[model samples]
Target chain A: MQDAPPSLLAVDGLTYAYGARLAVDHIAFDVRRGEVFGLLGPNGAGKTTAIACLSGLQRPAGGTLTFDGAPFDPVERPADRARLGLVPQSLAVYDDLTALENLVFFAEMLGVEDPREAAVAGLALAGLQERSRERVRTFSGGMKRRLNLAAGLVHRPELTLLDEPTVGVDPQSRHHIFEALETLKAKGHSMLYTSHSMDEVERLCDRVAIMDTGRLLDTGTPAELAERAGLPGADLEATFLELTGHRLRDEA
Target chain B: MKPRGLLSAAMCIARKDLREFSRDGVGLLLAFLLPLVLVAVFGFIMGRVGGGGAPMPRVDLALLDLDRTEQSAALVTALLASDTLDVVRPGPDSAPWDEADVRERISSGEDPYGMVIPQGYAEGADLILLRDPGRDLEEQLVLMSLVGALFDAGGEDFAWEMSKRGLEASGLPPELTGRIEAVVNGFRFAVEAMFDEAQANGSFDEDAAFGGGDGADDDGADGDGENAGNAGDAAGGNAVGMAEILQLTLPLELVDVAPEGRDAQLGYQVTHAVSGMTVMMLLFSLVGFGRSLLIERDKGTLVRLLSAPVPKSSILLGKLLATFFTGLLLVFVLFGFAHVVFDIDMVSRFDTLLVLTLVNCLACTAFAAAIAGWARTEKQADGVSVLLILTMSALGGSWMPSMMMPEAAQAVGRFTLTYWSLRGYQGTFWYGQHWTDPEMLQSMGVVLAIAVVLLALASRLFRTRYVRT
Candidate 1:
């Protein structure tokens, strides 16, 4: 019998807590190569926590994460991180440095041998080649968001994790970021994309997982979840509301 | 870990930090321009204070001439010609021969010496000199002695003129007058010789000659005269043995005399202060840079870096190196300003000063890192850093000379980097002591040791506790 193809990233029975309160509770997920997986949730849902845990930022209280069949220890195993990249919600790129410098710095951090070439390629892919030498401080919020996404891809990691990468950006930059993500998908790069925008989930995600209160509420293609929730021919937003209920989850 | 790879990562972090800092205009200004401004201001103030140059003492005098004779006026004019005494005319109601008023003025401690030429003073009466004992004793004594010598010579001239007139009246020849003067001097010499032998042999208990002190112990009797001679010798040693020249000019020298000992040259003092303040302010740069760690961590940049292949240790080391280099750069800028503007000598004992500055920079970086480790926000780090820097400046004698402070305070100041740095700098330019001098070497050792301990503590704290999970 031949061994099964390795999952690009796997998180099993993951659980994490903030103080006495549980933030990520036993959430299970896996991303295969060439798959664009969407983690859909409203604000304060366990989306960021799950991503943090999967990216090895937080140690799961009770779970195991493996990348390409290798056990992941975020603190000790720096080699595991070479295969992963994170584009945080906030623009983590240095504002005082130029766009190219920012990309090169991140590339260097990820152990890229030819950071300049990697930076140029990443900038070209993000359509920021012309603005590569401009300081990020001068860039618009949307432009900065696009540059942040490009910075994450400079080292060309196999698994990229984007946590709310498109929030608060202009529609133009948001479009650019989505187009870039789709292009990456076409190029067969796997990604774990988390966002609250159901339309984005519907458009970009090959498979969508709905999470609320640290638990996976549902997991399937948008159409399948919509059908399972009995919302015939409805968009993901209506189907999500039907499955998770209408009450606000503002109170902890 | 591969050495080359680690070096590459460290270099990358350093390059990134340098780029960011270079582009940060406000940071550059704070790190460099502010210290230059402070040095300029301090230098101006120090120059105005006439620091370590000399003391300028002023004196006033009042002279009373009762005898309106030409001779008496000439004698008064001679006293007025001296620069040490600023001669002033007496008030209208003042009697020219009023001994009471002269004594009052001298006793008031304003005029150091007062001279009263009594009635018939030029006609061979003794002049009375009043001196203020409370004034500088050397000035008072010198002025009194000068007046005594001048008047005694005047008396001798007056006596010769009177004898010439008497001889003319008696129809005696000049040859006969000279023979009679020789006979009188011989008789006087014989009496003085007898007195001198008696005084030397302690056979005479003449209280008047010895000022009431017994001459029984000749050695003890000679001690006061020896001390006076020694003081005269010291004063004479500074210049050729021209006592008259010293008396005429020493008063002027006293007006702006530098404090004895401590090598308090104005240039050295100003440079020392500027260097100290530079070190102090550069510590803030470290705090400022270290606050970036807190800000980045809070903003999730630290998390992002950690999420990459960068180890946490590398991240911390990168920050430490950045802070250290920034501090050193700040020192270079300050030293440059000191060299150009204040004319601070840099090359003499350069190794020692360099070692001192580097150690201080390390300590400052470590201190900043420790503060960053404990602080959770930029505001807290800034507030605490300013407070610490100010306290250190105060304790380190940056504000004032530690020697001028109370002994206990000075002792406490020894523990501060500013004190040791100032001492090390003074050792270089002021005392001209070499870096290998035991005292300077010891101070350097203490400062470097402190830097090591602080760095270790800061590194441990940063590594073990500062990172939030």
Candidate 2:
């Protein structure tokens, strides 16, 4: 009915491999302006590989990525790359640096106007303002996760790529992070969120793409995907199970 | 990217690295204090062994006097009175230091040096020098001391006898030998007459005899030219100078041609210790800093850096800058400590030292970055870097004098940065060469070339392994 929000990032025929084995097999998705897009998969389902390709840490074998109505290749079009912010799955903040120092360094890297001011603002946004001066090495996993998110957000790019941002965090810190993401959404920022948690994806993502074994299985809204799975009114977990199956992914 | 922007990013990264390095107290101690302590220990040991104001210690020589003649006794007393040798002789009751006993002593390594004055030593028999091999420098000193003792004890007689024996032993045709012996005898006669005149007169007319009566142009000319002047004076019916006559007959003076104020042996060992340790530890500390890249990759922070909006080269350039600055500081600190503790004259050659040190640090920084970039893991980096650095240090004469190595090993040492670095410092401190000296420039050029090659390799490795993925 209503026109889908104009796509800010569009991918087509994206492919990658680790040697002979395919890790991202011609999969495609889009994150429209001002909305959260989710990529859902099991442990070895290539979600992180897709994120790595999008964030320029990797070069895909075959793909045409479009950002803001222009062809985007991070290596060739670094200005387009500047519009992206990537939060890797690992806790990537420097342990020896204070929270404020880490944020400021990232801000400087991203060419923020005033690194200290942006760092302070990022600290407040992550709910880590009180401990900004303390080294990240002393922080709990949850606190570090929060600061990690804040570090990624210092430059406030148009699209934030968050790969399993809630991993290893306490439920309270997860709630705090979700609240921060919600605030960014309220501010009209876009995000591409990847995770294994169906509930979090159902709650935060306006659209979802389910992948398995490096190939996209489906993409739809939660209710639409549930209905398509023959479970109307069911939660996203039921639809996820139906699409990706119940096999133990770690063993695979 | 703009140059300013690139420089800004690089500085930002370098600052971050320096900050992190500063926070690791143990690392700081290892990087800074360890070299100082090692240098101090090495400096003290080298000073005691072969340095200090004295160039070498007094050598102990076993003396076997088979002649037991007045000339042999005079030789023994002169050697004993000399500063360079401690003459060890048999006691009155002991068997008189036989050649067999001394040879056995040398062969068994109980003593490494011995000398035998044969029964005909006073009658033109060759004196025997026996020693275990592998002590060439000490052997030279012993030879010099023996010659000086001979000159002191036997004077012109010993000189004439030794000359005649040398001429006869040369295996030359008898005709040539006879002519040489005749000329030598004439020169000896002239020298004896000059000595007698000098002994009779209270003061010898040195200028009239040696300078051909001009007295204005002596000015310490060469022996040949001074001999010509003495000839001219003699043809003019003037007396031949004693020194010129002796110079023609026996040119056996031992002169140290080291730089005016510096002690050659002491300065050489000091420079060897300082530059060797400094260059070796630079690779250690700089590569240790470069290993931060591997640490960041393991911690996943490298991915974040790649994801940031900066030219990828800026990161590596930042590491290079940080490493270079750190290495420079470490070098200056070590040298400063050496200056304070060992009294090396660094201030006199500060400019030249700084230039060489800057180039040396750059080469080391490039080497560090290349190792860090090429290694796939920290463990691999550690193992490879240690192996290469230690090998380079040893081959480059860091552990011992390159001259002590076999000729081929010394040739191989020329390829190592440590050798060139030590050579440059030796040029500066020992030979008193300035930075613009050709040898110093060659050292800088070779080191700079090594840096360029390593930097290019590092760039390729970083691109493949970290940047492009």
Give the number of the best model, judged by TM-score.
2
Winner by DockQ: 2
i-RMS, each model, one decimal: 3.2, 3.1
Candidate 1: what's its TM-score on chain B? 0.57
TM-score of chain A of each: 0.94, 0.97
Q: Which digits, one per residue and each the tens of the lDDT, describe model 1 over residues A1-252?
A: 955435778878989998888998898888888888899877677898888877767767888888778787765567777778899988888888999988988887888888889999988877888998999899999888888898888888888999989999888888899888998999999999988888887889888888888898888889999899998789999989987888888845
RMSD, every candidate, angstroms: 12.3, 7.2
Off by over 4 Å in 2: B1-4, B52-249, B260-266
Model 2 / residue B150 / CA error / Å: 12
Query: What ranges in model 1 sit over 4 Å off?
Result: A1-6, A230-233, B1-5, B47-268, B464-466
Best by lDDT: 2
DockQ list for all candidates: 0.37, 0.40
Interface RMSD (Å) of model 1?
A: 3.2
Candidate 2 lDDT over B1-469, as tens digits, reads: 1112567878989999999889888879888888888888776666644444433456778888889899888998988876567777778898655678999878887766898989997776878988778777787667767777777799768767777778778787789988998898999899889878886986666454432353222343454323212222322121223334454447433222345445423545666777777788888889998898888889999898887778778888888899999999998998888778777778988999899999999999999999999999999999999999999999999878899899999999999988888888778877788999998999999999999999999999999898875
Q: How good is the docking of model 1, as DockQ?
A: 0.37
Model 1 chain B poorest 10 in a row by lDDT: B231-240
